[model samples]
Target: MANIKLTVEEMKYMALLQDLTGAVARDCIIDNENNRIIFIVRPGDAGKAIGRRGANINKLRRLLGKEIEVIEHADDLEAMVKNIFAPARVLGIRLAQRNGRKILYVTVDPNDKGRAIGKGGRKVNIARLVLKRYFDIDDIKIR
Candidate 1:
């Protein structure tokens, strides 16, 4: 696990999430530029974090006035990357070193590339941020 530091607002949001859904949050990323907050909940808690009919997440979105995306935490980097692109079928990942930095080349289902990249590349940016923080990955390239 990485050494995660939470800001006051993040801690507050996490507390609110737990209170609302009874789910344990492993990490929280505040994407102000995108007007959203991403929460990585404990393994096996994704469904709880989302709640029945997505009621919990919907409530949080309304309460925070920001979009809420909850992802399940994974024990390994490969799984974490996969989780980051959930709903988009990832075929594989190739790890390579360059300039003494680690980079990831991800191959996903051709048809879902746009979805994986997301609107205005928001999803890819978030994936880069999360992977850089947690795994020291320098960058990612989608194939």
Candidate 2:
């Protein structure tokens, strides 16, 4: 696992989230440009993080005034990537070593390519960040 440092704002949000959902947040990403907050919860805690019928997430959205996305963390790299891109199915994931660097190639359903990339490539950027932090991936290629 990578050592992720949280900003003051992110730490505040994480504290609020833990108090509200009673779930441990493994990672938190504040995507201010997209008006969204992504939280990666501990394994088997996704449903708890979101609450019943997404009530917890909705409450967080209303309180924080930002969209809330909850993802479950996985031990495996491929599984974790798939979880991060939920609703937009990933066809496959390939890892390659080149020039002493590790690169991750993700294949998404052609129909959902746009969504996988998100507006202005935000989702893919997030993917790259998360992969780099946790898996030591140097880059990501979404296909």
Q: By summed lDDT, which 10 consecutive residues of candidate 1 come out lowest?
A: 69-78
- Candidate 2 wrong stretches, greater than 4 Å: 32-35, 98-101
What local lDDT score does residue 98 receive in model 1, on the 0 to 100 scale? 94
Highest lDDT: give the candidate number.
1
Q: Candidate 2 on 1-143: residue-level lDDT in tens?
A: 78888899888888899999998988888877778888888988888989999999999999999988888899899899998787789999999999999988999999989888888887787787677878899988889
- Give all TM-scores, in the order shown: 0.92, 0.79
lDDT of each: 0.90, 0.87
TM-score of 2: 0.79
RMSD (Cα, Å) of candidate 1?
1.4
Clashing pairs in 1: none
lDDT of 1 at 140: 95
